[model samples]
Target: MRPSSILSGLSCAAFAILPCAAITVDLTSEDSIKSAASTIANGMMKFYSGNVTGGIPGLLPGPYYWWEAGAMFGSLIDYWYYTGDTSYNDVTTQALLFQVGDKDNYMPSNQSKSLGNDDQAFWGMAAMSAAELKFPNPPSDQPQWLALAQAVFNSQALRWDPSTCGGGLRWQIFTFNNGYDYKNTISNGAFFNIAARLAAYTGNQTYAEWAEKTFEWTRAVGLMSDDYYFYDGSDDTINCTELNHIQWSYNAGVFLLGAATMWNVTQSDLWRERTLGIWNATHVFFTSQGGQAAGQIMFEVACEPNNNCNVDQLSFKAYLSRWMAASTKVAPWLYDDIKPYLAASAQAAALSCSGGDDGTTCGTRWWNNGVWDGATGVGQQMSALEVIQSNLIDRVQGPVSNSTGGTSQGNPNAGSGGDSNPIAMPAAIETSDRAGAGIVTALILVALVGGAWWMIA
Candidate 1:
């Protein structure tokens, strides 16, 4: 076992106890980071009841969607990779495997009505991380990690719509879903992220081409601005005439790491320039001018300052923190430029984990100078857990490729059969099967009612 001072005497099962005090991380010490991450992760998992009765594996409770659960597992995978902590690995693996539907892709029948392309991609990305980091594989009979990721990529590749904005995946999968008319950055950026990582891992030219195509389409559609500020997305009903213009941390983060991965594999001057440009543009999210934070902490510039962030938006910074830290591994030149911001953000994020009954629950606002802000949820805890653990990026090796010791198998044609089709809604919902189609309909209705739910992701 990896040596650890905090977990030295404790068994893996004992790691779930909530902290009585707020986490403390000495960014310079690996042990301190692990200890702090352990507390924050436990605090975060307290919101999860997925494995208990009346709960579903791979699914979070009310107000939390399946996609966020996928994202949270991705962070947990990172936690295991960084700290050598196996405390949550079993649950993480269980959740990831349970979501891989019958086709071995992430398009489970239960999530079909509400599943957006981005939602499925989040789980696929987690599987990809498992493959790259050599996280323990599932049982021999279960779906493998790299193949699961490829299955997701293959499924999404078929959904690429050229009819509206030249070429881009719609925000939702089904033509009947509310966002089928909107082509958003997260959906396309997520596709790009997976494709680029696949290209890097498998050394496949086709994935590389798709990644390049997606980037060009995003740029041409005006969703990605000239200054590299990636906007939310636009509706295709107008032929992409109008843009949302609001920027999100995850949009920029998703594309930034994809571009960086492309550069890592191709070493093309063009990819290098794009990667650096996007990295530079990300400075907008970091405080540079005023306040006590002033260029230190990372904030969702569009919503955080106004205290208007929804549950999903609260977790956006987690991906931003995750991608920025992971990008440094692929693009080593980014290490110096990205480290300070992550370090300061980790410090601030940890301070915000001083709320909730355990006193270690995280809050949405990190700039509140250790004040709880009375906010507590999976997103807040997750955002804190991610940024805090990310400070260990420099301590580990970069992600690996097939040529570089990756063992998870891949299937280029994994999701092309009956499973590729949009999940069919049942003619009638039985009481016992309400968790299937009924929940899907409810989610679709919520999305339709929100109308602006696309903006939140």
Candidate 2:
């Protein structure tokens, strides 16, 4: 059984009894489509902190909750784009617009005490996504769409300190968390992605410059390894020698899309090289051991087998899946190289969806034995959904055309950087590009499920 089709055959039997008639949840299932994993995660684990930073952990115990919600929301948008379900479209536009809050400032409204540069950057990526996708919005007094992303970008730019590794964004915007002394890859990579997207969307040269500068810094600081492995971050408290060796999926994922976007916009060999480099090297984030092969599996190497990923790390791979699906538009020639891996990974992930007290729960151990790994959460479900969606998205929407920066033929853009229509990569490199949730109390499960072009969600 191809992994991509595992869930397509899934039906109401996979989920708990719904309020309405049990609806099938393949690539269809209109408004009834539900990502209950996301709903439960959002409802139980996330709550508004009232624009401050410190309060209780809302519902979930943690330092950064809103940002997690933001990341999940971003994934939800990807789900929307790939599926084009539109059921979640209003949910996305409505909540995110509100989150942007007075004057489109995510920080003031989000008020996450642990709001690191990476945290805010997540929302920035989402906002850019909405703008590029041309998500409908009500005319508001403040900046609503791309401008909101710009606001976050500008805020980070103001705080960009040259003291560390020549130049980098701080981990935390505030000194409250000791993380302020650190510079992490996700922060810079997310920024790099946002810069590339903005440059592509607005045709702004300044954003492109920022993208190159950010990558150069990552390369210099040893965070972005020569082979494209994205190391965690540098600890200024340790004189920067302490390069936290953790390799998270989101780090590589962002750089993949960033390079893809820049390549599409600038048509430069530099960005093209970056696109291919990250695409090829991203296999390091996963494991190919125990009979699995590198570039054919999708385990979060840092937290698999024994160590389960934390909430933040849980949905990390979704970003990679999201961007890789998008990157195909900037370089259609990569379809042969990219889609199969996603399908195989998606199959492995689908096998992890165990039906139990928590419903149809999924986990992060995609390369484990055929049986489910007993891991469950919104992050897990989201991650599984992301990989599955990537492989089958074309079936529903058809192939995206090369003119719109995609080659899906009839399929719509699943957030492949919006309609500016990325230029197809030259035949030379012919490359390249580019979830879950949960809390401790068992897991939430549902059978049914839940997007766009040009700006993939």
| Residue-pair clash count for candidate 2 | 35
Weakest 10 consecutive residues of candidate 2 by summed lDDT: 430-439
Report the poorest 10 consecutive residues by lDDT, candidate 1. 1-10
Model 1 misplaced stretches (Cα beyond 4 Å): 1-21, 288-293, 418-457
- Cα lDDT tens digits, model 2, 224-288, are 76778777777665435546555767788888888888788778787788888998977765566
Q: How many Å off is the CA of 12 in candidate 2?
A: 18
lDDT for 284 in candidate 2 is: 63
lDDT (10s digit) by residue, model 1, range 147-217: 99999988888888776667788998987878888888999999999999999999988788888888877
Best by TM-score: 1
RMSD in angstroms between candidate 1 and the native structure over all alpha carbons = 10.7
